[model samples]
Target chain A: MSGEPANREPVDLAAKLASFGEHWSPRVVAGFNGHDVMVVKVQGEFVWHSHPETDDFFFVLKGRLTIRMREGDVTLLPGQLFVVPKGVEHCPVAEEETHLLLIEPAGTPNTGDPATAATKHAI
Target chain B: MSGEPANREPVDLAAKLASFGEHWSPRVVAGFNGHDVMVVKVQGEFVWHSHPETDDFFFVLKGRLTIRMREGDVTLLPGQLFVVPKGVEHCPVAEEETHLLLIEPAGTPNTGDPATAATKHAI
Candidate 1:
């Protein structure tokens, strides 16, 4: 690859989980340019917030998650994807539990707030 | 989420494989802004080419592969990532078999050649 190539072996979700044991917190899995790719295990409910200057993408690696927005709610199952626009307030919740792989800019606040506890957990 | 947020559920490789059986070809799993995130099942050998105006990224979701470059070769496994800079000629091959998740600009040529056989498979 012409871009900064990082040669790595195959990594499984079970192996990634073995590296951490926290809920609602994300851990760094890899990086590209100035961005950080994170994997998070979430259950129950998460606070509602929005990123004003950056874009965020989420892919469920395992389980299911429901994203509640100011206008409506979107439930995502395996193989499906949803997009939340910039400055759109949203809350993510899982009726049971969900595992997700998220990609975004480095230093993005977890809760989209610089002063919130979730912000402290940014991977 | 500030970016074009795509809410997607956990998509396992086996499930994705059940959707296709072709080798060296990719299918679209999701889209980001003007870009497309694709998953490809590849084995054996691939041709040499380069994208001139875009940056391409690859994450080894499964298996093993090596990128042969003019200078040297880089072997990649799962969890490892590589960025192929624009205009760099590179060839990919596998000693065994490999699956990968590739993200790049939508409508990009597969072999970086707009008129080549590989260009017909852009997902």
Candidate 2:
């Protein structure tokens, strides 16, 4: 565990997904390198913003996620991934209840705007 | 796609996992920042090595993966993850035909040693 302490205990996916119930709020489940792997249940639309310095990786675990960008929208079904590069304007919309895993730099704000209530909550 | 071109197509995970039947070899499926999101079907034992400057991340997509280190071995099951810090000698052994997703700096060899045959192939 000391060698890979971030996630030494094997986390049961279904159990972790079932542990939380909320929307747009990410719960940190593990860490890798300098990034944090988080899970969130989302529905409706998220704020339009962009990370100025790091990319955002999103993997759909359940349902679907449509990321609205300047050009078009990218819809991600379960088992799909999308990387939103830094400094790009984007918004994520979940038409139905969607389970997602997000990977990004540690301590990154949930929304680009720091004042947003959903900024950087580990749990 | 251009804004988030690395994984713009929203890759079908099942299809990708289904596409390949081999084990140990990693197929590049997408990128985040400068990192590669890869999936590999692994079974049996891997070499003992370490990346000197970058951390290596392993996520269990199916079955289980055990990373052996000096202190102890970290066992990862489905939905579990672990980050091997830079310069840590480690070996990965999968008890069964385990499917996994690896996230790390692009161009990293499958094994730490550069002379290894299984070095950096994007399938």
Candidate 3:
């Protein structure tokens, strides 16, 4: 068996979500392998943008999320996931308050442009 | 808005879990950034192993999962996650059938040994 390192603990997604109330701002919850697991609460439409260097992952935790692209819109409910390939410009909108889990490379900007992206806070 | 690529669709975790019944076998459900998102069903106990080069991520979807390390064990319930850092030898056990979501670098083995690892079937 491997020795557990100090501070290694399970992350409770629900508890993390409950700790914050801000919308659109993502909070870093856990990380591994150069990736950061983030949680965000969102409602309404977000700016259209594309991550030119990395794909964007979104897993709906509660409510509904609609990813709108030029071709069409993909709606996701809780327990569903969608991936937006790199360089694909899209917008995320939630008709109701929605909770989301996002997996992305560390330092990835939410708006694709670092200058305009919302600051990612660790929670 | 970004143009949606052909074959882009949301993945339902529940439906994917229901489609398979084998224990300890993982099915690749999605891929991005040289990483694979996999779903697995596990029960009983797994062999003690460690990934020498990559961290192991686990998110419990149903039932209970316990990751046993030399120092201690971490138990996870639905919506909980834990990351086993690289080179940490550990074993996963489940007294009841459990559904899990795992994220790791593509080609990483379940047993840490390629020859003994279960073949990852894409579903």
Candidate 4:
């Protein structure tokens, strides 16, 4: 191989999700570089937040969700992806149960502003 | 938001594989940089070959597989990943059946040294 230690392989989202039940909170599923990848099941709405130094990337593995941006909204369906540019305030809402892949720096706050108790480090 | 156009998002291997039925051959599911991300169903033995200028990364999405290399063999199970470094002559054999994610530069040969008829560009 690349002479590098193999990381976690063949990740199964279904199995991972089966291990927990929660909303908003995410669990670390994998890591690459200095970033953490988290998988979360979301419904309803998340708090509006902004990561000053980090960009957020989300992939909708299942269901439907919308990223509400200050200037516009990006509605995502399965196989669709969108990135919220750094410093942009946004909120995510799920019309139904959704499975998503969220990528950001390892320490990124679930709540961009982190001014409330709902902000979590589930990852 | 990296100020870049969004490409395909939130890929689901199951859905992609559902659209095709084949073995060894891969179908392009996504692209990043100059690389193509493919999903493949593989069983039995593959050819021994090498890509002098490219590295290949594999993630076992399901099942088990063994990479036979001149130096040593790397056996992979689900949730384990391995990268075949550039210029290594290796073959993959699945004792049972397997589903895998293969990432490599666009146009990389399926049979690395390519002197065969089974070689394909299903992606």
Among these predictions, the greatest lDDT belongs to 3
Ranking of models by lDDT: 3, 2, 4, 1
Query: Which ranges in model 1 have alpha carbons more than 4 Å from their true place?
Result: A1-13, A78-80, A117-123, B1-22, B49-55, B59-90, B94-99, B113-123
lDDT of each: 0.68, 0.79, 0.89, 0.70
Q: Model 4 off-target regions past 4 Å?
A: A1-4, A7-9, A117-123, B1-123
The count of backbone overlaps in candidate 4 is 6
TM-score of chain B of each: 0.83, 0.89, 0.94, 0.87
Please give each candidate's TM-score.
0.70, 0.87, 0.95, 0.55
Model 2, runs deviating above 4 Å: A1-7, B1-7
Model 2: which docking level applies?
acceptable
Estimate the TM-score for candidate 1. Answer: 0.70
Q: Alpha-carbon error at A58 in model 4, in Å?
A: 1.1
Model 3 residue B89 lDDT score: 84
Per-residue lDDT of candidate 1, residues A22-52 (tens digit):
8887877655435566778889999988887
TM-score of model 4 relative to the true fold? 0.55
Better of 3 and 4 by lDDT: 3
DockQ of each: 0.27, 0.47, 0.56, 0.15
lDDT of 4 by residue, B42-108 (tens): 9999888877676677767778988888777888787555667677777899988799877666777
- Provide the DockQ value for model 3: 0.56
Report, in order, each candidate's fnat.
0.18, 0.48, 0.56, 0.11
Per-residue lDDT over A1-91 for candidate 4, one digit per residue giving the tens place of the 0 to 100 score: 3334333234556677767778877877665445566788899988877776766767676789888876677788865556666677778
Backbone clashes in model 3, listed as residue pairs:
none
lDDT of 3 by residue, A1-123 (tens): 343472457899999999989999999998788888999999999999998788888999999999998677899999999888888878999999999999989999899888999898998
* Candidate 1 local lDDT, B18-85, one digit each (tens): 67778877887665545667788888988988786776577676788788776677787765566666
